[model samples]
Target: MVEPVDPLQRLPFGARGPLLDHLSRLRHDLGKYVSLQVRWLGASPPPEALRQAMMADLLETHRGPGGGIDAPTVWAGLRPALVGEVPLDDTITVDLSGDVDFERLDDAMARISGVVRDLRGGVDGPQTVATGIEAARTVSDACRALWSRLRGG
Candidate 1:
């Protein structure tokens, strides 16, 4: 993973606690989005189709192109990395692995967008780093595409 532009590890303990706590929560929140994405798509999803919101830090580890990170694969990676076993499976399943397409995709993304917006709104103060902001924005923008065009946020 790229070291954050700021040397976060060097901060003094008292000053660091809040930032560390936020970062940890940030990780779980991002992971939750991916897990929801996987279950929404089914047991297997075409990562390429959902590639627009790829997590920059996970791209190399997932071994997919930067633009095509496999979200289902990343979801597996997120499970072990969760802090204190936070559950990320509370998502509505849309099942696009069969005949359904855009309608299911749009519905899934619209629901996903709400979670993404909540995640974005929760980020503040020390948690508003570029990586966090960009990740949230990427997913929010991606999820907004269909529903925003069809209706609104």
Candidate 2:
């Protein structure tokens, strides 16, 4: 029987740290907002469970057998979280009437798409830095969207 290789091991040395760090931060940022949304809806947030699920999905989607980051797969995993509607109760007094900043979200998605493309081709120092910056920006944009939805702005 052949041993399965760890896909993460295949990433370039310079790229691996930044990419992993980006993923970790992204998960943290999103999880924070998710918890906030749940609370806003008068429900308790399942912090650990949500974090674990998000991390697992991200790892499965990005860490392929060939060691290449799949942009589509990453997008697929993110789309639900990015565009999902929070279940609000009519009896709840929280304002839940606002348009999401789709433009910002789209830009963030585009940035991530570019990062995935660069990773697949092979990341150098500059590319790694750029990807990290973009990943942070993406997280910011997502948070903004969530806030907008919650505020009805």
Please give me the total number of clashing residue pairs in predicted model 2.
Answer: 1
Tens-place lDDT per residue, model 1, 1-153, is 854332222333343334334334433444345434423444444554334233232232234355444333443343232222432233211211221222333344344344434434653232323233234344434333322332321
> Tens digits of per-residue lDDT for model 2 on 92-144?
11211222343445555566556545555655345443453445345456645
Could you tell me the TM-score of candidate 1? 0.24
TM-scores for all candidates: the values are 0.24, 0.36
> Which residue pairs clash within candidate 1?
none
Estimate the TM-score for candidate 2: 0.36
What lDDT is reached at residue 117 by model 2?
A: 58
Clashes of each: 0, 1
| Residue range with the least summed lDDT across 10 consecutive positions in model 2 | 87-96
> How far is each candidate from the true structure, as Cα RMSD in Å?
19.4, 20.3
For model 2, what is the C-alpha lDDT against the true structure?
0.41
